[model samples]
Target: MQADIQLLLTADGSHTVRHETLGVTYHSIHGAVQESQRVFIELGLQAAFERFANVPLRVFEMGFGTGLNALLTAREAERHGRPVAYTGVEAYPLPPEESQKLNFDVALGTTFLNALHASPWHETVNISPFFTLNKQQTSLQNWQTNERFHLVYYDAFAPSAQPELWEPEIFQRLACFLLPGGLLTTYCSKSYVQRNLRAAGFTVEKHPGPARKREVLRAISPPIL
Candidate 1:
């Protein structure tokens, strides 16, 4: 483990990494697995699947910390026999040595996770027939892409960890990356966060959060003016 990182066992027996320097964990300490399954997969991916059945869905994730969200999404795509093209942007990717210590593969009973971690950054890898992943190692502020997505998993650390990410300019860029009516879900439901999304032209809603959290936000993109 890196000197600045510590692995913590969450309430659900899952491992989460705490960045001692950044003062944040990769996932909620309540239960890393449950948080991903609820916020990203169930709320974001599953809901999008309902409206985009039989279509190859495009998903963009802001932070690909442990690859947990991507792994769960791949399973969901296979379970429903749908296809998903996932793009995850991480300014600072977790080291392979540390990510290897995570037990999500065994916990989820999946083998492709190893492949996800091995796949080189900045290239799209076909991890499964139903799932394609593109991991970009660049900050959202500096990253550029013309592709749009149907759903976005805003899994970045809390505003306290990286306040710049929660600003209005970032939300405006995210809004432009989505097709009209597309969904963006995150574990954050802070009032100012909602205001930023609204300022960026999203119709925001608060939904019941998973353990240790009260609410989450799911925002819909409106046509760009």
Candidate 2:
């Protein structure tokens, strides 16, 4: 079930991909960069930094998509001189030519985009002194790792578009890899999704979202005894 995709300019003048068949955009049409910065960066990464302090951060991104979130996280790690190990899981990766067309690098004034996509799958690649990436080519449902993560960027397509991915069982499985006190953040604010997170043993919160979005969800794992 390969997605028929096309690139489109977003409200913030950044680019995002739309799955033609699913009728869903990879990021918010409001602004791809703005959404990523707000949902995954400010609320997700920054919050993790505050909680973990100077410790190395491990992040697992559910859908690598355009690599925008990873790029933003990498830049943040470099800015703070903090170490971050990022693992992004994508079942169907965008082709090289497709990723090259995204305007994220130009928007952020950085050229790490190509290096991010070119990194070998299933192996860690040091993109910078502070950031390393492991782009795993597997679906989140099937992906497994004994290694736990400090943060999770749940950037999958909307539930309406991909209901299977939003199921409670899937969330439970992902929750197992989150270290106690780790967070899972997403642009989705659906009640069912929140219930699923709660069912998976997360303390979920809804926060003011970015741009046109009203709310986003952030779920934290319970602290270990």
* Best candidate (score: lDDT): 2
Which portions of model 1 miss their true places by more than 4 Å? Answer: 1-3, 223-225
User: What's the C-alpha lDDT at position 211 in model 1?
Assistant: 97
- Candidate 2 — what's its lDDT? 0.92
Query: How do the residues 1-225 of candidate 2 rate in per-residue lDDT, one tens digit apiece?
Result: 344789999999999999998889999899999999999999999999998997999999999989999999999998999999999999989988889899999999877899999999999999999999999999887887999999999998888888998888988887888899999999999999999988888899999999998999999988861
**Which has the greatest TM-score?**
2
lDDT of 2 at 94: 92
TM-score of 1: 0.97
Q: On residues 22-118, what C-alpha lDDT tens digit does candidate 1 reach at each position?
A: 8999899999999999999889999999867777999999998889999999999889989999999987777888889899888888887788888
Clashing pairs in 2: none
lDDT value, residue 135 of candidate 2: 91
What C-alpha lDDT does candidate 1 achieve relative to the native structure? 0.91
| Model 1 poorest ten-residue lDDT run | 1-10
